[model samples]
Target: MVKNHSSLLQNKEFQYFIIATTILDLGKKLSWVALSWFVYQITGSALSVGIVISASTISPLIASIIAGGILDSYNRKNIIVIENIIRGLILSLIPILFWIDALDLWSIVVVVSINGMLSSFTNIGSRTILPSLVNKNQLESANAIVSMTSQFGYLIGPSIGGFSVALFGEPMTLFFNVLCFFIAAFLYSLIPTESYQSQNHQKTNVLSTDNRMRKFFFDTKEGMTFLLKFKPVLFIAFITFFFNLTYSPFETMLPIYVKDILLTGPESLGFMWTAFAIGAFLGSLLWVKIKRTFIYSYALGLIIILWGITPTFFVYFSNIYMIYTLMFIGGIVYAPYNIISPTIQQILIPNDKRGRVLGVIGLIGGLGFPIGVYFSGMLAEFLGASTIILGSGVLTILLGICVIIHPSLRFSQMTNLDNIKENL
Candidate 1:
C-alpha cells in the first residue's frame, strides 16, 4: 500500500493536477477574503456582504442544470483549462474598474456571478476526473493528498489576502488573485491532453439542432435517474444539503463577527481562517493514516458532532486566542468529511455517468447555500452574528445526531463499495 501510494504521488499527471488544484484554490480563497472584506468596508452592512457572497452561488446553481451533460460529453481537461482562463480574464476587470473608480457593488456582483457559473464546470470536472488519475487502491490516498494540499491554500491565502488588503489595498490583492488563476490554468494545461479524454464523448454527425437538444435532455435525465436509484449517494447528498445550509452562515457571518463582535480588523480575520486551515491541514494528514478503522457513516456523524460543538463555545469565549482555538478544533473535525464523502461518491458512481450524477447531486447539495447565506445575513442583522452562529452550531449538532441514528447511513462501514451498497 505504501509503495502504491508513493507511485501515485510519483505520477507526473497527478502531480500537475494536485499543484493546479492547490494554486487555483489559493486564488479562490484569497479572492473570497479580499472580496468579503472589501464589500464590508464599502457598505458596512452584513446584508451586503451576504448578498455579494450569495451572488457567486446563484449562477452556479443555474448552470448546474446542464453542467452535467456538458462534462459527460466534452473533455474535462479542456473544460477546466478554459474555465480557469476565462475566470482569470473576468476577474481582471475588478482591479481595473476599481483603479478607475468605476467599480460598484452591482458590478462586483455581476463579475462574481459570471465567475461562479464558470467555476461549477471546472469544480465538477476536477472531481469527476480524479479517479482516472490514480489506481483504485490509491483513490483514498489521493483524496487525502488532495484534501491536505488544498487546505494549504486555505492556510496561506486568507492571511496573505488580509495583509495584502491592509497594506496594498483590495485592488492590488485582487490583481494577485487574477495572476494565481492564470498560473493555475497554465499548470492544468500542462497535463497531457489524452489523459482525461471523456469516455462518453459524444460525436454528433448531421443531427438537427432539435435532435441534439433532445439528446442532451435525455442524457441529463438518465444521470438524474441513476442518482435517485443510488441510495447511498442520494442519502449522502441529502446530508450534504443540510450540512451546507447550516455551515454556510459561518462564511457570511465571520467578517461581521470579526468587525462587530471581536472588534478587530482584517488581519485578525485572516489569522482566524489561518488557524482553521492549519488544523484542517493537520487533520487531513492524520485522517489518511487512521481512516481505515472507522465506519464511514458513524465516523462522519461523530466528526460533525464534534465540529458543531467546537463553534458553540465561541458564544462564550470572545477572546481572540480562544476563538482561534475553537476554529482550529472545528477545522480538525471538518477535514475528514471533505475527504471521505467525495471518495465515497467516486467509488460508487460509474465513470461514464459520473459527471451528470455528480452534477445533479451538486445542484441538490448546493440548493441550501444561497438560502443560508442570504438568511444568515438577515438573521445576523437582527440576532447578532454571535447569536446566529450559536444557533447554527446547535442545529448542526442535531443534524449530526440524526446522521448517527439513521438506519440507512449508520450501518455503512468503511469497506468496499459493494459491502457499503449492501449495508445501505
Candidate 2:
C-alpha cells in the first residue's frame, strides 16, 4: 500500500503528534537547564551538579529494558499522551515546593529521577511509533526533521532557560516547563486513530502469550542476536558507548567547570551551552553536505576527538568568546553521530525488534553518563575540572585512532540505503 505521506503530515493527528512532541522537548530541555543551574547555585560545587545529573539519568538507564517492553506492548499514542500529562503534573509542583522552601536537595533528586523514568518510557514509545506514521522512504528525511527540531529546541531552550533563571528563578522555569508539557499533552490527543490502530492488532497475535516475562526475554534475545550478526551496528554501538563515556562528562561537568575554573556565573554557563547546542544545530543541518565530503564513521570519530579536546584547550585559554566558538565547532561535528547512529538502527534492525535494540543501545550508551559523572565528579573534587577534561580529550583521540586501525569497524556493513532496501 502506498501511503500518502504529505497528506499524513497534513492530517490533524500527525500534526498534533509532531507539534506536541516538539513542545514537550522544549520544556524538557528548559527544565534540565534550570535543574543544572539550581543545583550549582545551592551547593556552590561542581560535584553536586554531576551528582544531580547522575541521579536523574540512572532511572532512565535502568528503565530502558522495561520501557522497551512497554513500548512494544502498549498503544503508543495513548502511552505518550498519558505520560506527558503526568510529567506536567509532577513538574508543576517544583515551583510551589521551592516557594515554601520545602524543596530539599534529596527531593529534587527524587523528582528528577521519576521524571527521567517517565520521560524515557515516553521517548521509547514515541520513537517506536513515528515510522508507522510515515512512508518507509521518508524515514531519513523524517528523522532529519525530528533532529532539526531537537537542535532548534536546544538552540532556544538553553538560552531561554538561562535567562529565565536569571530573571525569574528555578521555580518559575519549572512552571514554564509544566506549561509546555500541558500543551504537548493536549496536542498529542488529536493524532488520527487509523495511523496507529493497524499495528496494534497486527502485533497482538505474535506478542500475546501467557508468560510475558518469558516473551520479554525472548524479545530481548532476538534484538541481541540481530546486533550480533550486523557488524556495523555492533561496532557503532561500541564506538558510541566509549565516545559517550568521554563526552558525557562535558554535559555533566561542563557548567561546573565553567563556574569553578573560569569563575563564571549562570549567564556564562548559559552562553557556553547555547554555543554547544548551536554547533549541534549547524552540524545536523549540514548532514546531507557532510555525507558527501567525509566518511561518516571516521569523520564521526574525529568529531568526538575534536569535541573533547577543543573544550580542554578553550578552558585553559579562559576567553569566553573563544570558548563559545570552540564549543560551537565541537557541536557541529557532534551532530551527525546522533543522526547516523539512530538511522543505522532503523535501517538495519527489524521493525519488530527496534524497541529492544534501541533499549540495548540506550542501556549501553547511557551507562556512560553515570560512570562518567561519578568518576569525573570525584576527580574534579580532588584534581580539578581542567585536568579531568584533558584526560577525556586524550582518551577520545586514542579511541578514534583505535577505531581507525580496525578494518572491521572502519568499513563494516557500509550504509547505503538503496542497497539495504534491495537486500530486504
Candidate 3:
C-alpha cells in the first residue's frame, strides 16, 4: 500500500511511464488543435471534420478484440514501444503530405483511422500494466496523478497551440506533436523489462487453438463473458453508452460551436478548453483527498448529475466568458468519472484479465462515438449546432436519472466505501 503519493515515483518504471504520458499528452493537445482546424479548412464544413474524426473512432469497434488478444499473448513493453513509434511515423506523414500540397480529406481520415487502431493496444497495455506497477491502495492516486497531467496538458497545450498555429501554421505545429510521440516511445524503450515485467497471471491463453479466425471469436467471447459476469462493470457500460453516444456528438460539434455560436476565434477556443482543464484539475485534486478520507459514492453520483445538467446551461449563453465558466464547471464534474473508473476496475478484476476485459469495455463505449458523430453532423447540417447541443444535454440528463433509479448502479457507487471498510 502506498502511504505517500509522492513516493510513487520511487519505482523507476512508473516514473518513466508518468513522464512519458505527460509529454505525450502535452504534445497531443497541440497537435489535436492543429488537426481539427486543418480538417475544417479542407472541407469548409463542420460535417467534414466530424467525418474525419469519426473515421478514427470506427476502428476501435473492430480492432479492440485483436488488440486485447495480442496484449495478453505478447510482451506489453514491446507493445508500448512499437505502438507509439508506429503512430509517430504515421502522423509524421501528414505534414510532409501537406507541404507538397498532396494532403486531402480522405488521406487524413486514413491515417487517423490507423492511429486510432493502434491506440487500443497502447491504451489496454497501459491499463493492464498498472496493477503490476503499484499496490492496490495506490491505484487511485496513481490514476489521479495521470489524470492531472493529462488535464494539465489540455489546459496548457491549446493556448500554446493556438499561438503556434497563428505563428507557425498548422502543419508545422503538427510536426512538434510527431516529435512528442517519438519522445514517449523513447521513454517506454527506457523501461527495463527486468524491473517492471508483467507477471503472466492466467494459466491458459484464450487463443491456444491453432485456428486463427476461430481464436479471435473465442477470445472475444471470453472477454464478453467476463464482462457480463461482473455486474458493476456491465452496468457502468450500459449507462455510459447513452452518455457517450450523446457526448460524442456534443464533442464533434464543439469546434463549430466556438466558431459560429460562441463567436470566437481559436484563441477563445483554447481558453475554453483551458477553462475545462482547470476545473477538472481542481476536481482531481479534491478527488485525491476524498478517496483517502471520505464517502465517495455521493461524489460519483453528484458528478454524473452535474455532467448531464451543465450542457443545458451551456447552450443558453453566447458570451465567451459565460461559456468558459460553464466549461470549467463541466470539467470539474468530468474529472472524477475518468479518474476513479479505472481504479475501480483495477480493484475488481484480476491482473491477467484486465487487457481483455478493458478491451470489451472499450469496444462497447467506442461504438457510440462514430455513429453519433456521423448522424449528428447530418443533423447539424440542417438543425444547426446549438439545437444539437441542447438536445444532447437533455438526453445526457435522462441517462443520469436512469442510473439513479437503477438499484445495481446505485449500489455500485458505494464501491469506494466498501474498499475502505475492507482496508480498515
TM-score of each: 0.96, 0.89, 0.90
lDDT of 2 at 59: 77
For residues 1-424, write the lDDT of model 1, one tens digit per residue: 4676689889999999999889888888889889999999998899999999899987787788588788887677778788888998999898898889999999999999999999888788888888888987788889988998999898999899889989998888988888888888888888886666566664522457787687778888999998887787898898888988888887789998898889999999889989999999989888877636556678878888898898688789889999999889888889989888898899888788888888998999888888899999998878988888887888889889988887655544445576755654
Which pairs clash (backbone N, Cα, C closer than 3 Å) in model 2?
13-191
Q: In candidate 3, which residue ranges exceed 4 Å CA deviation?
A: 1-3, 194-218, 291-299, 412-424
Across 380-412, the per-residue lDDT of candidate 2 in tens digits comes to 888777777778877777877776665543433
TM-score of 2: 0.89
lDDT of each: 0.85, 0.72, 0.76
Q: Over all chains combined, what TM-score does candidate 1 have? A: 0.96
- What clash count goes with each model? 0, 1, 0
Which whole-number lDDT from 0 to 100 does residue 77 have in model 3?
77
Candidate 3 to truth, TM: 0.90
Which digits, one per residue and each the tens of the lDDT, describe model 3 over residues 1-424? 2355777868787888888888777787887788878888678798898888788788766788778766765577778788998898898888899989999999898888898899788777777777777776677788988888778788898887878887888888888888888889899888776433434413233335565456555666787788887776766666556667877777788888988887776777778778988999898888777634433344455667787787788678898888889989999888988876677767776655677788888788778878888889889999988888887888777666666666654433434535533543
How close is each model in CA RMSD to the real structure? 1.8, 3.5, 3.4
Model 2 segments beyond 4 Å from truth?
1-17, 193-214, 290-294, 408-424
- Give me the runs in candidate 1 sitting further than 4 Å from their true place: 202-210, 411-415, 419-424
